[model samples]
Target chain A: MSAITLFGILDVLGTFVFGLSGAMVAIRRQLDIFGILVLAAATGVAGGIVRDLLLGDTPPAVFSTLRPLSAVCAAAVCAFFFGALIDRLKRPVMLFDAIGLGVFAVAGCEKALAHGLAAPGAILLGVITAIGGGMLRDMMATEVPRVLREEVYALAALAGAAIYVIALRLGLTETIAASAGVLLAVALRIASVRFGWQLPRAPGS
Target chain B: MSAITLFGILDVLGTFVFGLSGAMVAIRRQLDIFGILVLAAATGVAGGIVRDLLLGDTPPAVFSTLRPLSAVCAAAVCAFFFGALIDRLKRPVMLFDAIGLGVFAVAGCEKALAHGLAAPGAILLGVITAIGGGMLRDMMATEVPRVLREEVYALAALAGAAIYVIALRLGLTETIAASAGVLLAVALRIASVRFGWQLPRAPGS
Candidate 1:
């Protein structure tokens, strides 16, 4: 498959996983069916929408194409029907979330670079695209975003995007760069969770 | 002044007031200077940015123009320096918030209409623009958005935007439609607060 085709496939996969995560959150919060769908869609597509908006990419892909939207809806419906089963698979969900983060980070960085954003801009947008959805989801749930308080979540995304940009700058192949970025992000995320690593907090409460 | 010019002026004023509200919230949360400024800017321009993005307006006005950015900065700086004084004037702050809501709602609706959005789309965008910033602010502060739980806040914005669209459809002049919308929104918001009016909540907490 072409690079663009691969990216598109992974993006849909990421959307499905993120949508599942959102659906679980809504179920945990006792939200109604409509609320589950809303959260699912928001967590699945919000980040990409923001990234596209920043790049002046009109009518963001999610709005223009059905694949991503379909993925989200399918995931939400699956979770709704299998809430108890999914609830018991917390570790698997986290694994999927980590993979989604990595995929999104690499995808976001590549798109930014394709749009001629400078290195710093590309990296920032990549991180934003990777983390924005979860942030929005947490906000909607009235919680401080996990990116702000969790185990190196945003930092892993930043590292992933930065590595991808650096590898490209150093004349690496696009495939190599993308793979390196995604692998690093997923590994770091999983390691952080396993080891309970955390960024330091400010002094006092 | 032309309708466009008037809308521009009110938009900046709305940005300033919303920025002040954000700054005050940051101060109340004991955030540092950088945090206050970040919240201020987010509260000031996020709504407009979202509206512009959804309408496919590239390089959102806040990024392309200095007026809105400068207004947010000025509000943040003022709030940082005069926090004690501003804190004592909660009623005034709320009044300004209500005015900002009306102005933003009208501006968003006009922009959406200019971009060829239909009535429902325009009204939805308008309400989103009016409530978006504060919703973001509360989210960043880890609070349930006041619009979701407060006294008829989003309803007022919805009513305002709907009125604007209806008036325009009825062949009212732009100025008349905008004025009616703003007046009704501000009046409704203030009255809601004054009378402790609230939308009914879901049962059993």
Candidate 2:
């Protein structure tokens, strides 16, 4: 597949999983249907929209195309109908989330580089794209973002972004570099969750 | 003054007050110097950046020019040094915030219309620009956004935007319309705060 096609697939997959996660959160918060759908769309497209905006891409893909909207709608509808079942399958949902995070990080990094951003900007945008959606969801739900308070979620994204940039610098093919970044991010995130790894807190209570 | 110069003054003033508000919040949360500065900049420029992005204006003003950054820095430094005094001057800070809200709402609406957005889109963007920064700040502080939960804050912005749009449609001069919008919003917000006006809560506790 062309690099564009590969990234497109990753983008849709990430949007779907992130939308599902957002819908689940809305359900838990007892929001009405409209709120659920809004949250789902917001969480699914916010990162990509922000990234596109930073790159000066007008009428972001989410606005110019139908696929992302359809993906978000599908996820929201699925979660609305099967929230209980998904709640019982917490491990599966978390695994999907990890995968989504990794894909988004790689796709975002690639896009930033394609837009001629320097390494630092590219890497930062990559991490932001990975974590931005979930951060928005948590913020709307009035909670501290999980990435800021616990786990190594953002660290995992950072590692993936850094790896992608370095691999590209070392002349790796796009596909191979992307795969390496995604795999490492997913593995690191899952490992952190499973092993209860967390960054240190402030010096005192 | 030209409309552009008028809006520029409002934008800078709004950025400064919003940055001050954000810095004060960071101080209250006991964040260190870097954290305070980050919050100040984020709160100051986030709304404008989002507005510019949606309008397809890349390398947002905050990035392309030094005025907004300087305003944010000034506010942050001021708050860092005088947080205690500012804390005691809560009423004055709130007054400044109301002014910021009014100016941002009008400026955002004007920009949206200038970009050829329909009435609904323009009004929505106006409200978003007015409340977006504060919502971000509240979210960063791990609290429900004040606009979502209490007071007549967002309503005031909405009213201002509506007035601006209507006046424009009525062929009012740009200055008159803008002045009317800003004055109404500021008056409404200040009145609401002084009189403890609040939107009704959900049916039950």
Candidate 3:
């Protein structure tokens, strides 16, 4: 498959899992149907929108394209209906989230690079792309952002994106570089969770 | 003064007040100094950034310049130090916030229209510019967005933006159009607060 097609697939998958995560949060918060849908859409696309905005890509891909929106809707519906089932399968849910995070982190880096952003900008955008949606979701739920908490999540995405930036800078092919980045993110995230590795917190934060 | 200069001044002042609002929220939430600074910056600029991005303005004015950042810093410091004094000047604080809302709402509308957006998009963006920062601050504090609440806040800004859009469509000069929009927003907002006017909520929302 072409790189474009692969990225498209990755975007849809990421949106689906992210949407599921958002819907789960809304469900836990006891929000109404509209609230659940809002959270799902925000969680699925907010990061990309933020990355695009920062990079000056107008109208955003999520606005021009339909796949991300459809994926979000599908995820929200499935999540709402199978809330209990999903809750009982925490491991599967977490695995999906990690997959989404890894893919999005790489994609974000690539998109910023395509927009001619410098490495630092690209890396930061990549991390934002992975965590922005979830951060917004947490904010809406009146909870502390998981990113700002003790989780190693944002740093993992940052490392993954930085790898992609370096790989590309070193003349690696697009697909190979992206794959390397995504793999690092997924492995790091899953390992962190499994090993209970936590980022240090500020005193009394 | 030229319109450009006026707008520059307005943007700085708006950011300053918005930052103060954010710092206050963070302080009340018992966040540390870093959190206070983060919230202040986010609240001061997020709205304007959102407006610029949606309107296809890249790097956002805030990112390209130092004034907005400096204003946020100053406001955070003032809010942190003179917290009680600011609290005592409730009426003045409210008025400054109203001014910020009015100027930002009109600025948002004008920017979108300059970018070839239609009246509807311009109007919506205008309102977004007025309230985006506060909504973000609320989210960071883990509260529902004030815009989505039952308050008449966003509607007041909407009405102001819509007026600006209509006035410009009818061949009004930019100065007159903007002034009219600002006045309407400020008046409506203050009146709404004074009269306790609220947008009706859905059943059990």
Candidate 4:
């Protein structure tokens, strides 16, 4: 498959997972349908929107394209219909969220590289792009951002970005590099969650 | 006084009002001190940050200087001590917020014109810069953006931007043009609030 095609698929998958996670959180918070839809749409597209804006793109992808809107609608519909079932399957939700994080990290790194950013900046952008939506979601929910407080979130994105850059240096195929980077992120995130790994809090609180 | 000096004074005043408004909102929401401080800082500097970024200026004003930070601290202190007194005053809070909006709108238009943007784009950006902080604040609070629903909020900014552009076309003095623009915005906003003016809602539910 072409690299662009693969990236597009991964991007849509990431949006789906993000939307689902946001809807789940809204449901847990007992928000109404408007809140659910708002959170879902914001979480599904905010990271990419921020990334694009930083890259000097206009109007933002969420506003300019149908893909993101469709993804949010699909996720919201599924959540509306199977809300109870999804809530009961906590492990599955976490799994999907991890997968979304990984896909977003890889996609962000690629976009940054395409925009001609330096390696370190591209990696940082990748990490930001992967976690930005969740951060916004948490802030809107009046909670500490998951990436700031939870298990290896931004760290996983950073690691994946680094892996993608290293793979490029080794002249690996795009698909192989992308898949490897995403898998590395997912593995690290899942391990951190399962094993209760955490960064130390900043001192002087 | 030089035009730049006038603008500088307006910037300081706008920063103060922005910080005060943010601190007040935070207090009303019953956030802790840290939360209040964060919101104050975010609201005080966020508009300038957005303006700088959109203008393609590097190292946004918040990071480049101490003025914005100091303004935030000062506002936080005021809110911490005099919040009750300020809240007791019926119209002071709204009046101060209107001043901030007016100053920000003028500043945004001036900055956009300086950056060589066309008049229409400058006006649009002026409105964006004026309301960007409030949008961010509302989003963080999980509320519908006031600009999207409130009475003539963004429209006031748009009017100020348009007036500024027209004054420039007529070769008015910089200070006179800017002051007139700000006054127009403030007047429109206050009137809108007093009279309960609102745009027509979209047709149908």
Candidate 5:
């Protein structure tokens, strides 16, 4: 597949899953329709936008183009109607989000690399892009960002991106490197949840 | 004075005030050194970065240049050391923040217009840029944004931007237009604070 095709698929899937996550938060907060849509869109594209900005890509594709924007809107609508059912299957929903997170992490890394960013900057951008949407969603909803609070959220993304960067340097093909990144991120996230892994909080209460 | 000169000065001054505000919030939350620095930098530059991205300006000046970054760092350091004294002088600080808000609002609008954005797009970007830093700061600190609360905060910025756009369209000098925008925003903010002005929150809320 062409690079655009590969990244596009991952981007859409990530946007949809993130949109669902954001919509779920809005539902829990009893927000109005406008708030729900805003949160959903914010979660879907804010990360990519930030990454694009950092990489000096002007007019982020997510904002100027229509495909990703449409995907986010569609996801928001789906979540709005089926939130109750989705909420009931929390475990499966989380698994989907984990996969989506990995997809986003790898995609962000690859995009940064393609844009000529150095390894370290690309790795940092990958993690930032993976977490930016959810952070924006929580902020808009007046809550703490889940990534900063607990668990190995950003760390998992970071590891995945780092794996991708190393794989690239080691002569792996684009598809293989991307796949490895995705798999690693997803596995780490699932394991963290299953094993109750968490980073220690501040020293005292 | 020239438009660029006026905006450059106001931007630097606004960055300082916002850095102070972000640092104050960080101190109140009792975050670590890293968190304080991040919050300060985010508040100082996040707004302009968002605006530049939306306008398709690559490599935002705040990140590419040293002056603004230095200003943010200085603000963070000052707030870290004298937070108690600054906290005690709440009234004066409030007045300073209000003026900073006006300065940022006008600068954002003018910058957007200078970049060839049409009136509507310019207005929206202006509002986003005016509020972007504060929203990011609050999100980083895990709190609801002050602009979304019970006050005439964002409205003041919006009104100011709108005034600037209108004044420019009416054949006014850039200096005069910018000045008018600043005056209106400051007056509205101060009046809102002094006279208990507030936007109606939801119909029954």
Candidate 6:
């Protein structure tokens, strides 16, 4: 598949996972339908919006197209129809969130590289875009972001971005680089969660 | 004074007020000093950051100068010193907020116009820049924005933007037009608050 098509698939998958996580949070908060939709929209598109804005693109994806709109619609539908099933999942919501983080990290890095950003800038954008939507969602929920509090979230994205850049330098094809990056991120995140790996805080105690 | 200088003064004044409001909210939430500073910085400069991004300006204000940093510092000092006093005088907070809204509305419109935006786009930017900081604050606080719910807030900014555009079209000087716009916005906002004026809800409310 073309790089563009691969990017599109990853983007939509990331949006759906992010939207579902946001909806789950909204459900836990007992927000109304409007609130749920708002949270879903914000979570699904906030990272891309920030990425676009920082890249000097205008109007943001949330305002520019129907993809984000459809993502929100799908989130709302899932929340309304499969609410019970979703709530009963054995693994915590963090599994889906990890998938989102992996996909978005790869997608964001790819987009930044396509836009001619240097490797460092692309990596920073990758990490930011992977976690930005969840950060916004947590801010809106008045909760600390998971990346800030729990999980090796941002670190995973950073590692994946680094791998992607290195692969590009080694003359790897786009699909191979992207697959490697996404899998690396997902594996690192899931392994971190399973093994309780976390960043060390300042030693105060 | 030159028109640009006058607008610059207004911009600083608005930043001060926005920072004050953010610090107050942080104090109310019982956040630590670091949290207070974070909120202050976010509230004082996020609107301008978003505006600059939308206008395709590189290295947004947050990265460009120390003025925004100074504004946050000033706010932190004020909040630390006068937290109790501010907590008691809620009316003064509202009045200061009105003034800030007026200044931001005029400044936003003028900036958008300078960027060669059309009247509608300028007006929209005016409203967004005037209230966007507060929206971010409310989102961080996990509350619906007061501008979205309370008396004639965004509407007042819109009115001021429209008046500014009209004055410009009528060949008025920039200073006169901006001053008139600010006054119009402040008066309308204060009047709305005093008389309990509000917009009609969307249909089906």
Please give the lDDT score at residue A74 for candidate 5. 80
The C-alpha interface RMSD of every prediction is 5.5, 5.2, 5.0, 8.5, 5.4, 6.9
Instruction: Tell me candidate 3's interface RMSD.
Output: 5.0
* Cα TM-score per model: 0.61, 0.61, 0.62, 0.59, 0.61, 0.61
lDDT per residue, candidate 2, A35-134, as tens digits?
9999999888888887787878766778989998999899989989999999999998888888889988988888888887777668767877888888
- Residue B114 lDDT (model 6): 85
Which one wins on TM-score? Answer: 3
Number of the top lDDT candidate:
1
lDDT of 4 by residue, A47-94 (tens): 987888778764345543578868876887677667888878888778
- The parts of candidate 3 lying over 4 Å away from their true place are A1-49, A53-114, A117-127, A137-142, A148-205, B58-60, B148-151, B166-172, B195-205
lDDT of candidate model 3 versus the reference: 0.83
Q: What lDDT is reached at residue A63 by model 4?
A: 45
For each candidate, the DockQ is 0.15, 0.16, 0.18, 0.07, 0.17, 0.14
Which should have the higher TM-score, number 2 or number 3? Answer: 3
Q: Report the lDDT tens digits of candidate 4 across residue range B1-205.
A: 8977877877777888778878888998999888888888888888888778767776777897898799888988899899999888749778878888988998988888887777766775687689888877776666655664567887788899899889989999888899889999999999999999765431221
In model 3, pairs of residues that clash are A142-B142
Q: Candidate 6: which pairs clash?
A: none
| Residue-wise C-alpha lDDT for candidate 3, range B1-205, written one tens digit per residue | 9877987897789889989988888777656555566678889988998897776677666644678878988987888778778878988888888888988999998889889988888898999999999998887887887778745788878988998888888999888888888889989989888888877668996
Candidate 4 residue runs with Cα over 4 Å from true position: A57-59, A73-81, A194-205, B1-20, B26-132, B135-205
Q: Looking only at chain A, give the TM-score of model 1 against the true structure.
A: 0.96
Worst 10 residues of 1 chain A by lDDT: A29-38
After TM-score superposition, the amount by which residue A205's alpha carbon in candidate 5 deviates from its true location, in angstroms, is: 9.8
